[model samples]
Each structure stands twice: as C-alpha cells, then as structure tokens.
Target chain A: MRFSVLGVGTSFVESAMAETHGFADCDMNSQLLSPRLRRRMSSATRLALTAGERACADANVDVSSVPSVFASIAGEIKVTDTLCRNIAGRDFPLSPTQFHNSVHNTAAGYWSMVTKNKHAAQALGAGENTWVMGLLESCCQLRSLTDKVLLICYEEAAPEPLVMGEQISDCAVAMLLGIPSDKKRSVCIYQQRVEHAGASTELWSPVSAALALAKAVRHPQNSSKLPISSTAHGWYAEVVHGE
Target chain B: MKQLSQSIPITAYSAVTACGLGNTPLYMALESGKNCLQPLELFHIDIPTCVGEVREVLPEISESLRRFDTRNARLALATLNCEKGSVRHAVMHAIEQYGADRIGVVIGTSTSGMYETELAYEYFRDKQHMPESFDFLNQHAWGATADYLKYELGLSGPAYAISTACSSSSKAIASAQRLIASGVCDAVLAGGVDSLCRLTLYGFSSLELLSEKPCTPLDKNRQGINLGEGGALLLLEKPDSQHADRPHLLGCGESSDAYHMTAPHPDGLGAQQAMHIALTQAGLSTKEIDYVNLHATGTVMNDASEMKAIKAIFQSGVKCSGTKGITGHTLGAAGAIESIISLLALECGMMPGTAGLTEADTAFQYDVMGASETTASVRTVMSNNFGFGGNNASLIFGQYADNG
Candidate 1:
C-alpha cells in the first residue's frame, strides 16, 4: 500500500535567503501568532507550529481530528539552559511552569491542548533523519487508524555559541500525508533498510532530512534521491525512488 | 485495531543500565531477586537517595558518533558497544531471515541532553564567553537521542521518540507494535533510556515528589519515587516459522485523562481507559491476565489513583504488584525496564516480588503480592506506566504460542 504526500509548508531563514533561491517570499516578521504564545514559545516551536498549521491548511485537514507527530532535533534548548542554571546554583529552585513546558513533548502537548484534539498525538525526535523518521511515523499512524497524519519537523539555530560554529540555521517544515487522492505536487515514499557505508561528517542535526525533503517537494524532477543523516550508533539514509 | 489472534516475536535485544551492561545480567538479577538500587553517588543530589546506577562507568567511544557535547550524549556514547551495526545488521538479517522491509525504532527518554544544555547556560553566563570545545549540536533537545540512534543504526524506515514522562519507553513499545500490525514496519526496536540530571532531581524535589530515603512503593510509610538513569532495547519482529521461541506482544492501549498536569485524575478515568483499552485490544477478559506490573511510584496521589484504576477494572483477587520498589522509577526509562521484568516473568516462570510493598491498602480488594517471588503457570502478563498530564499506557504480553 503506497501513501501519498499531501501538502508541505516550510519556514526557513528570512525571506532574503529565500529570494536568493528563487523561492516565494513568506513574511518572516508577519504577526500571525498570538503575542502571549509567541512570547513563551521558543523560535523552534513557533516556526514549527506555523509550518504545521500551513501544511494542514494546504492538506484541507481538520486539525482537531488529525493525529499529529511533532518532531524536533532539539526541543526547547532554551528551557534546558534555564533548568541547568537553576540546578547548578545553591538553593536550586526550578520554575514549576517552565518545568512543565520543558517536557520534550510540550510542542505536541500544546498542539493538542490548543486544537482540542482528543485523537492520538505524539512528539518524536531523532538526531539525523528527523524528517524521514517523522514521515515514516506519520505514515504508520495513518496506516494504523487515521487516514491522515500531520508531521511537523523543526530545528532552531543554537544561540550565541553552540559549537559547530553555531552555523546551524533556524527552520521548521511540516507535511501532511494520506492515501493520494490528489495527484498534483504529490510524492511517494517507500521504506528501504540498507547499510549506510558512506563517509561520516560532523553534521548538526538529523532535521537535515527535512531540508532534503523540502527540496524534493519543491523539485519533483529529482524523484530518485538519497538523503542520509548520522545517529549516535551509525547512519540512517533515506532513498526516494520512482515518480 | 483488535488484539492479534496470533503471537508477535521478540527476535533480538540490547540494553544498558545499572543492573548490568546487557540483558543477561538484568535477567539474572531479576531471577535472583537482586535489587540494583543503592545509595546515589553518580551526580550531585543534596537529599539522601537510592538509585539503580550502572556498576561500571562505560568508557568513551574511541571514534565518537556525533559532536553533541552533553552528559546525556556521554551516557548514550558510553552505552553504545552493541556490536557495530548490530541494529541495522539485525534488521538486514531479519529481512533475509523473514522477508520484510518494514522495520523501525521507537525510543523513550524524559530529558534528552538537558544536562549538557544546562551546563552550557552556566558557561555562557559565568565567563560571558562560549567555550571553543563546547559543541552544542546534539545537546539542544531531547529528540537528539532518537535522532542519533536512527542515524547510528542506519534505519531510514521509521523511527520516533516517545517522551511521556515515566511511561515514555512503554509507549514507544506500544507504538512499535501498532506500526508492525498495520504493516508500516515488519519489525521495530522498542525501548527507553534516561540519564539522571540535576534538572530532573531539582524539579521533582521542588514538587516534593522525590523520596528523601529509598523509595517504598505501596508501603504504608512509602515516601516518594527515586529518580534514575538508563536505557533498554527490544527488537520486535513479526512471528515467522523459524522464530518460534520469541515472546509475543499481545496488546497495547493508551489514553489521556486531561487531568492535572503533575497529578493523576482522582478517579483514575484515564488509567481505567488505558487498562480497558489493553484488555479490549487483546480481546481477552480481565480474568485472563496472570500478573500486573503496576505504576506504583510511591507518591500518595499516584498510588491512590493506580489503586482506584486497578479496582475499577479487575475482578477481586487478581494479583498485581509494582516493581519500582526494587529498581526505583527510572522515569521515562521505567516503562522499558518494567517491560523487561514482565517478559522475564513470562520466560522464567518466576514473578519478581513488589520489593518494597508492605502494608496492603485496605481500600482496594485486588491481590497485592508482598515482598517475595512466586512461581506460577503464567500465560498472559500486563504492564502499566503513567506520566505527567494524565498520559498513561498499558501493554499486555501473552505466551509465544497463545499470541497467535
């Protein structure tokens, strides 16, 4: 049984960067989100939520009924820093509110809470193929019960000094999937288990899989593609074949 | 989906914990009724404590996998000696042996690399400078663990990390089964690991959830839960003619009560839904269950809610116990660890006791096993794990043959 990719939305570095790539300009500074939610939300979450919402809209999905798989390479790195600071000092007093939001599942939790989705919801993260894994998980969820699964993948450029020369850019991408009813802009995903006998490098996060995916969605001519990312144990490579 | 009328098999497994470096030691400890819990000495905890810490400090990997500099990464790297390419090798071997391309990995963890993130904050603030050696790549979020694992294992099929508090790992297993049954994957790696961190300890302490002494689950004088660290992995594959000896996953059920954030529903509505889901998914009546691994965390609210949930579903006289008293609650890792205990009970025919269970609460009528082992003819076993925000999951495993 083959599943069809429905719609994809991505929020990347400012519009200036997109302009260079001949991509449509999406207002990065647009105030589409509530101030309070935006205030508390890390850039990763805000971008992720926005991208997911746009993709859901593109897929013509009722966000309330769909099961969502929100994937991130690092969830709320800022909160982790806050907690660490509190713990390292004398009289370590953790912020009860921040502590609750710090749960890696918080993004999905907020999605469910905000959308009032009683359906199954999950938050997933993998270092390398965050996008590929998110898609697989989404496909699996749809195969199990739901007809459609929303997969949101995102990563924020680590602040000031996060090694890797902090060259990592902030971006979020969301894709909605279902049995292909619409043919236009649709891509098919097939599962392959192969040994990754490739050169390894110091990559930032597996969310790069999402970047590769966005590229695929934008450029269908490159149907047969292979995107690989590193893990703590080895490497996971996603090979897309066929139109 | 309804419970599989046939059995599912566990073809391979890997584990890293204080109980031992691998699964054999863990099984032996459970069989001999050994408690891995000891005085806490791994990290800085002001309170007196008991923990299930790995006896040996795992060495650094010679050829490091990723540049994410975090304590959680260190722990993950330390635990990474599972025969290079064991995971992907197992998947390919399974495909060759069973003829299936659907394979996945479901991991669980509460705090991914928060320990390292925390350290980064201090370094940035104190010195007003970022360390040249500090690589913040993988330490930014909890998904890194799952991300790193997928890449490390070369699993491009399907993977996700479940972070439902203490039940995280257990939920991962449930998801893996669902994926397998739905044909999303032919096999899956399901388990969990959580390294101890000051953020977790201080957070729990602030909420008065950590026990000042060794945790005593189900005891009248029970205090609270002891935070722990570790990981466990179970390779799940669909049943085939050649793999007749594998244990079967019968059913899995999940629910959320929408109750208080840190506390459970007073009436156990979510817990009941989860238990009923498990039984219903398995297509078996409550009477068929041989034993229950309860989510008895020793917190007054948690214990009370679990008791209420259990009594609400099971008929009187069904035997159930919490193994947390022995291993302490490993938080997100608890579900995976307890799952091991449940399988061990089925395989070894010996039920590990509720080590710290003493005075039985008279409010509930179920049979609560005291601090001792029992050998019984077990056919089906159930394990429960609940997390913050009323997230709960229950899994049922049957004898290999009866599973089908």
Candidate 2:
C-alpha cells in the first residue's frame, strides 16, 4: 500500500533547532486551547498538541475534519509517577485532575478538546514500535476510510522511579498522510513486509522511530527503506521521492 | 465517502467481570438484574466507595510466562480461559486455517498492570531499591496485555494496544475490522482488559466521581460511578459462507467530544454524531435499532449528557439501559465488556435493565428500563462507550440469519 506525506511537524530536543524542521519550540501556551484547558494539560499533552497544530497548519487543513491516530510509548509518565508516589505514600486523596489526566489517551483527548475536532481519534501504544504501529493503523484507516489521516507520535521523560535507567527524550512528531489528490506530492510511502533482519536501528523509544520517519519524509531520498521495529518479520516502509 | 461496512464475524468471545468468571455468569447477572457492587476489600483506601471487584481466583500463569503475571493479565487470562478456553480454541482453529502469522492480536487497555507498578513503587519507597523482578515492559507497559496475549497465543500478525480511555476496546474492535478490510490480516483477536488498582479508585475518588453506593444510572438520585475491573475478548474474522450464523459486527462509529477532557459535551453533540455515524454505516435508521446500551457512568453530568444524546437520536420509546449498575464502570475494558453484553442481548433475546435504578430521571424523554425483560426479540443492538478526552464510540451488532 502507498500513501502521500502532505505535511510534517516535529518537536525535537528542547535545545535542538526544532523550528528549522518546521516545529516550534515546545510551548505550553497554546492558543488552540482555552486557559482552563491549558492549565490542566501535562507536558506530553502540550507537546502532542503543539506538533498536531503545526501539522494541520502546514497542510492548511482544518484539524477538526481530519481523523487522527496518536501514538505514544510511555503515556503521561510524570502523571503516572505522581499517582504512584501518592499511592506509595498512602496518600488517601490523590488529585482528581491528575488521575484523570494519567490515562494514555490524555494527549489525544486534549487534542480533540483543543481542536474541537469530533472526528475519529485513536490513541495507540506499542512499546518502542508505537510509531510504526501508529503508521500502520493510519494507513489502514486511510485505505479503508479513503480519507486523510493525521498521525502523531510523541514521548517524554519520566521522573526517577519510572525512568529507571533508559535515557528518554522529550519529543513529538506529526504527519498529515493521505492518498495524493494530485501527482505532485513530494514523497510516496510504500509499505512492504520484509525480513526484520534486513536492516535495523537501535531505538531507545518510540520517539526515535517518529524522528527517523520524519527525517525520511523531510529528505525524501529515493529507494530508501526504514525498519520500523526490531521484530524479525515486521512491516517496514519504502520511501519513493517524487520529482 | 460511502464505503461498504465490513461485516466481521465474532467467532468467539469471552468476558470476566465483577459479576462472575465467564460469560455465563455475566449473562445470568444481566438476566437477573444482579448488582455485583461490594465494599472495597481487595485493598484498603480511606474513601467510602464501592467497587465491582472480581471475586473469582484468577488462574496462575506458567513459569515461562511468570514475568507477565499481574492482576490485569490474570483477569485477561481468566477471560480467555472461560468456556474451556473458547477464545484459545477459536484462535487455534484460525491459526490452523490462516497460520499464526496471518492472525493478529489487538488488545485495549488503560492501565496495563498498573497495580504491579504501584506495588513496585511501594517496595521502592520502603526498601529504597527497585525490585529485581520488576520488568516495565512485561508489567507496566500499556501494550503488556497485547504482548502477553500475543506470546501466549504464539501469533505474529500486526498486534498493538489501543488506549483511548473508555473507548479503547471499542476502537480495538474497529481497528480489527479495519485490519481485515485493509487485507493486513485474515483474523484478529480483539478486546480489552483492565484490572482495578488503587490509582483508579483513588483517581475516581479524587475526581469525586465514585459513588458511595452502587451506581444507579439514569436514576434521579444517582451520585457517581462505582469502579469495576474486568476483561473481555472477541475473535473477529471476515464473514464467510460457513459462519453466517454468527453474530455480525455491523458497524462502528467513533468520535471525539472536543468538549472537555473529563466531562462530555454538554449537548452530547459528539455522542449523537457517533451514534449517527454508526447507524449510517450500518445502513439502518433509528427505527431499526431494538436496544441501546448506554454509556451512562451514573455521574450526574455523564447521565444527563448521555440522555441528551439519546433524546437527540432515538424516538421516545426506544428501550435503553445502563449495565454499569451491575458490573460497575469497567473503565477501559467497558467497551468490549459492554459490547459482549450487547451481543448477548442480541443472541439471548433479552434486554438487561439498568440495575440499581430506583427512579428514572424525569428530565429525559427516552425510555430507561428499570427491570430486565425477556420479551424483546432483539435483532440489532447498539452499545455506546464514551471515555475521557471526550472520546466516544458506538458499535452496532446485528443478529445473523443464515440465508443458506
């Protein structure tokens, strides 16, 4: 199956040159959300919303009209840690807002509320393969629904206890994908099942996968295949840049 | 775009909830209008709230799968082990027909083994050292349930976890249908599982959304939701000539509220749109629906908003009920669990009443059943599940008639 990349948005390391890649610095102040809604959002939700807004803006599409698939490896880890800490301390009363925001779909929910987008939204988690799985889900939806799909993959660093030893970065990536209405699309993504051992990259988290896919979309190198995960016979993408 | 609705056959399904161990108990509870809510016993919390805890002893995992052992996984395993492991039987048959690589697994969960994470945190808090056996991937990851199911079933198709709050499992079913429609897989094991943890109880309590008594949806005196724990699984495959008798998943409609994170749209716009989409996709009108399984969480806002949506969709007399009074709100697993209930309603020709409902809220015009009834010849039924972040989903299941 093939799909066209219509727009791309990336939120890299805080100090990195994210604006150069069409992403603004991760800003918590979102004009898309009301002040009340903005105050309740976590860092992860802010990152996802920022990237999603940028993607929609880049594509010049109404965010509310396009269906979205949000993928994350560890969802709202800081909130999870907060709840864990409260429970560990035998704190009888945990903050209700924090608890509700601790769900894996918190970011996705915030996206919908902020955008006022009532379209179908899905929140997915697949460990380190979240981005690829999310891509697969989006492509399937696009094929079945025959509509544009906004795909967002994001992750953030957690506190100490949940962090363990794995080094995680705060980042988010968004892409507007669809069947090209016009032939002038810059890149067409072809999905193929390949032997998982053909080529692989060491990915610490789902954010790396999103960054790699964003890189491919940005550069549009011809005849390039990116392994989505380390699974032996998983699905990989073959990028064909259009002239 | 008007696309043909993919009629996926639910070959096998199972659920383990607070009502009992298997679908049989769940069906019986629904039939008898049983309320399974009980005072908190499994763990201690200072709040005075009731819960729908699974009283049945969960099966112990084998040594190899011990790393994945957790309350949530155990509840999921218990559901799969129901009816002499009917889900496994269906999976094995699908494997024989389609090969393991062609059958995928998609599990929906909100808090996968979060209880284990809470325990690990408690241990660390006291010992100042993380436990040696603490594996985040196996226990705390949101994909842990899917991973555990995949490993246990030995299938290799496109497996992942959906975590769209309460709509997780409902979307999982929709995703499975999409996977089949996209020709990505021949068959998919799709469902949801969520085991109760202190975080959820305290979380709901913190939100003041937990009812001190058993939840009473659509009742004038309703307070809040009574949290529950359960797991439900369904084996979905393309409708073939041989399985025409099986219940068919007619259509799925999903929408985001875009209203609020914790609260629903005041006017139930998203909820109505979701139900509308489901009815449109199913090629049915409001008159064709025999029953509606409401997503009423017993909270004042949820019930009121859902009533508005129901009023906007169906006619004055369309029968509706909320099963949370019987099973409590199962959170992420609710979509699949309630879908199973809707399937049972279609198959058994019985519509479960809204248990614990003393008096219907007079503000709504819809008919909210307060007692179970066996007179309805249920053919097509819709199950509604709305989650946090204003995520809403509605699934329509139709009773299959063998034309052959």
The predictions' CA RMSDs to the true structure, in order, are 4.9, 2.6
DockQ of structure 2: 0.72
lDDT for each residue of candidate 1 in B200-229, tens digit (9 for 90 to 100) = 877887787888777777777888888777
Give the clash count for each candidate.
25, 0
Q: Tell me how candidate 1 scores on lDDT.
A: 0.68
The runs of at least 3 residues in candidate 1 whose Cα sits more than 4 Å from the true structure, single-residue gaps closed, are: A5-43, A46-61, A89-91, A163-171, A182-185, A190-243, B1-7, B14-16, B21-35, B64-104, B116-135, B138-160, B182-186, B315-317, B363-366, B401-404
**Docking quality class, candidate 2:** medium
DockQ of each candidate's interface versus the true one? Answer: 0.33, 0.72
Question: What is the overall TM-score of model 2 with all chains considered together?
Answer: 0.95
Error of 1 at B34 (Å): 5.8
Report, for every candidate in turn, its global Cα lDDT versus the true structure.
Answer: 0.68, 0.83
**By summed lDDT, which 10 consecutive residues of candidate 1 chain A come out lowest?**
A232-241
lDDT of 2 by residue, B1-404 (tens): 74545677889999999989888999999999999999978887888988999988899877888878998889888988997899999999999999988898888898898988999999999998778878776788787888788878878777789998888999999899889888888999999999888898888888888899888989999999999999999999877978788998888899988888888888899999999988887888898889999998999999999999999888555889999999989888999999999989988999999999888988875579999889658989999999998999999998873210
> How far does residue B71 in candidate 1 sit from its true spot (Å)?
6.0
